[model samples]
Target: MRIAATLRMALRALRRNKMRSMLTALGIIIGVGAVIAMVGIGNGAKSQVEAQIASLGQNVVLVFAGNWSSGGVRSGWGGAGTMTVDDALAISREVPGVINVSPEVRDRQQIQANGLNWNTQILGEGPDYLDIREWPLQDGAMFTDQDVRGTTKVCIVGKTIVTQLFPNEGPVGKSLRIRDIPFKVLGVLSPKGLSVMGSDQDDVVIIPYTSEMKRVSKRTNLSSISVQSSSPEFSDIVQRGISDLLRQRHRLGANRDDDFTIRGQQEIADAATATTRIMTVLLGAIASVSLIVGGIGIMNIMLVSVTERTREIGIRMAVGAHGRDILLQFLIEAITLSSLGGVIGIVLGVGSAKLLSAIAGWPTLVSVTSVVLAFLFSAAVGVFFGFYPARKASNLDPIDALRYE
Candidate 1:
C-alpha cells in the first residue's frame, strides 16, 4: 500500500507539470534515437563490406608473373614471362593445402554473336579455372580437360555477355565469334556481381589457355595464376609453399629478388573489416555524447522540481511520510519520464532507419540488440541523474521547507 501510494504521488506530481515533464524527456528521446540510427548505419556498412569480400571467392590467392628489368629499364609485375602453366601445376601438386590452381592470360577482342558485335574481355584459362574460383555454370557444363589440351575452339560466357550477345535465347551451344574466328559456347557462368576493383565480373568470355596461346595472343607465359587453399586457415601456408616452389623452379638464388608476386585475398578482407570497425566505433562515440547531455537535462529539471515541491514535501513529512517514501516518489517520476521517451525514441529511430534506406539508397540494419540496449541505457540515465535531486528532497528539514514562501 505504501509503494502504491508512492507511485500515485509520483504520477500526481508529473501530471501537475506535464509540459515540463515532456520537455525534460526530450533530451533522452533525441539521444536514444541518435544511438539507434547511428548503430544501424554502422552495422549496414559492415555487412556490405562482408558481402563484397565474399564476392571475391573462397580461400583464393593470386600469383602474378615477375617484373621485367633490362639494363636501366624495368617493367612492373605481371610484365614478365616468369609465371607459366607448369608453375601452377607444380603448386597444386606440391603445396600441402592447395586444392585448386589455374593459369590465365587476358586479351580484348570484338566478340560477335547473333549477328551483333560486342567488345569484351577475353580470358584464357585452364579447365581448373572454374574449380579454382568456385565458379559454376548456370546452364551447361564446364569445358573438359581435353578441350584445354587440344586447344579446342570452345568457350564459357558470363551472364553480362549472355545478356548482350544472346538476349532472346540460352547461351549454351551458341557460337560466339572472337577476332572473327568462330567458337562454340559450352556454357554460361553463374552471375558474380562485381570484382573487388569494381569491374563487372560477368562481362567476359573464358576459353582454354592453350587456344588463346595458339590461335590469338601467341603468348607462351601466363598473365597470372589463381590458387585456392582447402581452407581459409591454410591460405598463408599454401602461399608460402607456392613462393618456395616458385623460387626453386625459377632457379633464383637467396640473394636475388623474387621473380614473382603472390597476393592473398584474406589481406583485403582484413583491411575492409578493420575500416568498418573504426567507422562503427566513431559513430557510436558521437551518439553517446547525446546520452550524457540528456542525463544532465534530467538532473537539472529534477532539481527544479524538488525546489518547487519543497512545501508539499514538508507537508507529507509532517503527515508521517518517511524519507525513503519521498525518495522513491521522485525517483519513479524521473524513471517514468525517461521510459516514456525511450519508447517513443525506438519507434522514431527504426522508422528513420527504414526511411533513410528507402530515400537515400543507403543500407541500414536495425537490430533488436541495439534497440534493447538503447532502452536500458535510457532507464539507467534516469536513475543516475534523478538520485541526487530525490535525495536532496528527502533530506530537507521540515521546519525550513514549510517556512519557505
Candidate 2:
C-alpha cells in the first residue's frame, strides 16, 4: 500500500510541473543520444577498416626498397632502389616459405580507348601478379608467362578504367594506347573500392613487368615485390626467410643494415586496428562528459523540486508517512524521469545514426551492448544524483516545513 501511494503521489507531482520535468529530462536525452551515436559510428569505421584489410588476403607480404645513401645523403623517394628482379628470383629459389613472387614496376600514364582518354596508374608485373594479388578477372583471361617473357603488347584494365575509357563498348579484344603504344586488352579487373589511403584501387592498368621496365619506364630497377606465403600462420617465417635471402644476395657484411624492408598484412592490420580502437575510446570518453553534465542538471532540478514540495512533505509526515516513504517517493520520480529520457534518447540515437549513414554513405553498426550500457548508465545517474535531494526532503522537520509560507 505504501509503495502504491508513493507512486501515485510521484506521478501527480510530475504531472503538476510537466514543463520543468521535460526540461530536466531533455539534458539526459541529448547526452545519451550523443553517446550512442558516437559509439555506433566508431564501431562502423573500425569494421570498415578491417573489411578492407581482409580483402587483401591473409598470407600476403610486401617487399620494398629501404633507404640508401649516396655521398652520405639519403637518395630516392620512399628509400627507393633496393629490391630488384634478381633479388625477387633469388628469394623464390632460396626461400622455403615463399610460394610465389611477382616484381612490380609502377608509373602514371594517360590511356586512350575509343577516342576517350584518362590518366591512370599503370603497374607492370609478371603472370604471378594475378595469383599473388588475388585479382580475379571479370571478363577476359590474364596474361600468360609467354606474354611476360616476350614483352607482349597485352594489358589488363581495372574497372574504373573500363568505365571511363570504354564506357559504350566491351573492353575485351579492344585496343588501348598507353602513352601512344598500342596494346590489346586481355582482361578487365573486378572492382576494388578506394583504400584507406583514399586511392582508387580499381583505377589502374596492368601490363607485363618486363614490358614496363623496357618500353615504359626505361628503368632496370623494380619498385616493389609481392610475395605470397604458403600458410597464413607462417607469415613471420616467410618474412624472416625473405629477409635472410635478400641479405645474402645483397652481400652485406655482418653489422651492415639491410637495404630492403619486408612487411606483412598482419602488421598493417594490427596497427590499423589499434589506431581505430583508440579513436573509438576517445570519442566515447568525450561523449560521456555530456552524460555527467546531464546528471548534474538532474540533481539541480531535484533540489528545486524538494524546495517546492516542502509543505507537502510536512503534511505527509503529519499524516503518518515515514521518512523512508518520502525518500522512496522522490527517488522513484527521479529514476522514472531519467529512465524515460534514456529510452527516448535511444530511439533518437538510432534514427540519427541511420540517417547519417544513408546520407553520407558511411557504415553504422549499433550493438546491443551499447544500448544496454546507455540505458543503465542513465538510470544510475538518476539514483546517484537524486540521493541528496531525496534525503533532504525526508529529514525535514514537520513543524518548520508547516510554518514556512
Candidate 3:
C-alpha cells in the first residue's frame, strides 16, 4: 500500500508539470527511435547482400585464372590467361567432392536478331554452368554436353536479350548473329535480377565455351572456372582439393606463389557482408549518444524537481514519512517517464522504418531483439540517472528544508 501511494504521488507530481516531464523524456524518445531505425536499415542491407551471395548457388566455389606478379607489376584475378580448359577438366576428373564444373569465357558483344541489335555479355560456359549457378531455364532447354563437345552454334539468352532482340516473340528456336555468325537460341534463362556488384545479371547470352574459344574471341585460355561441391559441408574440402590440383597442373612449386585465385561461397559471403556489419555497429554507436544525453537531461530535471519540492519533503517527513519513501517517489517518477518514452519510441521507430521503406524504396528490417534492447537500455538509463537526485532528496535535513524560503 505504501509503494502504491508513493507511485501515485510520483505520477501526480509529473502531471503537475506535464510539459517539463515531456521535454525531459524527448531525448530518450529520439535516441531509442534512432537506434531502432538505423539498425533496421543496416540489417536490411546485410540481408540483401546475403541474398545476392546465395544467388551464386549453394556450395559453390570460384577459381579465377590469374593472380601473378612480376617485375613490380601485379596481375589481378582474371587478368592473366594462366588457366586452361585442361585444368578445368583435371579438377572435374580428379577433385573429390566436386559435383559440377564449368570453364568460363566472358566477353561483351553486339548481336542481332529480328532486325534488332543489342550489345550484351557473351558468356562461354560449360554444360554444367546452369547447374552450378542453380539457374533455371524459362523456356526450351539448356544445350547438351554434345553441343559443348561439338562446338555447336547454340546459345541460351538472358531476359534482357529476350526483351531487346526477341521482343514480341519467344526467343527459343530463333537465330541470333554473334560477329555475323548465326547461332541458334536453345533456351531463355529465368530472370536473376542484379548481381552483388550491381550489374544486371539477366543481360547476357550463354554459349558453349568450346564454341566461344574455337569460333569467336579465339581465346586459348579459360577466364575462370565455376565448381560446385556435393554439399555445403564438403565445400572446404572441395576448395582445398581444387587448389592442390590446380597448383600441380600449373607446375607451381612449394616456394612459388599460386597463379590462380580460389574462393568459396562462404568466404565470398563473409567478405560481402562485412561492410554492412561494420555500418550497423557504427550507426548504432552514433545513435546511442543521444540516449546518454537524454539520461543527463533526466538527471538535471530530477535535481531541479528535488530542490523545488524540498519543503514538501520536510512536511512529509514531519508527518512520519520515511526518507526511503521520498527516495522511492522520485525514483518511480523517473522510471515512469523513461518507460513511457521507450514505448512511444518503439512505435515511432517502427513507423519511420516502414515509411522509409515505402518512400525511399530502401529495405528495412526491425527485429524483435533490437526493440527489446532499446527499451531495456532506456529503462536502465532512467535508473542510472535518477538515483543521485532521489538520494540527495532523501538525505536533506527536514528542519533545513522546512526553513527554506
TM-score for each of the candidates:
0.87, 0.84, 0.93
Put down candidate 1 lDDT per residue, 1-405, tens digits, no spaces.
Answer: 277876787778888888987888888888888888888888888888788887767898888888978897988878768888888889888989988778889989889988988989999988878877778889898887899889999999999998998999998988989987899999999998877557898999999998998888888899988888889899889889999999999998989778888889878888877877788778878887887798899999999999998998899888888898889889988887787778887888888889999999889999999999999988999899999999999999888888777
Q: What is the lDDT of residue 135 in candidate 3?
A: 95
| Residue range with the least summed lDDT across 10 consecutive positions in model 3 | 1-10
Q: Whose lDDT is greatest here?
A: 3
In order, the Cα lDDT scores of the candidates are 0.87, 0.87, 0.91
Number of backbone collisions per candidate = 0, 0, 0
Model 3 C-alpha lDDT per residue in residues 1-405, reported as the tens digit of each score: 277887788889999999998998898999889989999999999999999999998789999987777898987777667899999999999999999999999998999999999898999999999999999999999988899999999999999999999889998998999999899999999999989889999999999999999988998999899999999999989989989998888889999988888999999999999999999999889989998898899999999999999999999888877888888888988988887778888888889989999999989999999999999999999889999999999998999989877
Error of 3 at 41 (Å): 1.9
Superposed model 3: Cα runs more than 4 Å off? 1-6, 69-76, 318-323
How many backbone clashes can be found in candidate 2? 0
Candidate 2, residue 114: the lDDT equals 89
- Candidate 2 has which clashing residue pairs, if any? none
**Residue 320 miss distance in model 1 (angstroms):** 6.2
| Best TM-score among the predictions, by candidate number | 3
lDDT of 2: 0.87
* Residue range 297-325, candidate 2, lDDT tens digits: 88899999999889988998899878988
Cα displacement (angstroms), candidate 3, residue 206, comes to 0.6
Angstrom error at residue 14, model 2 = 3.2
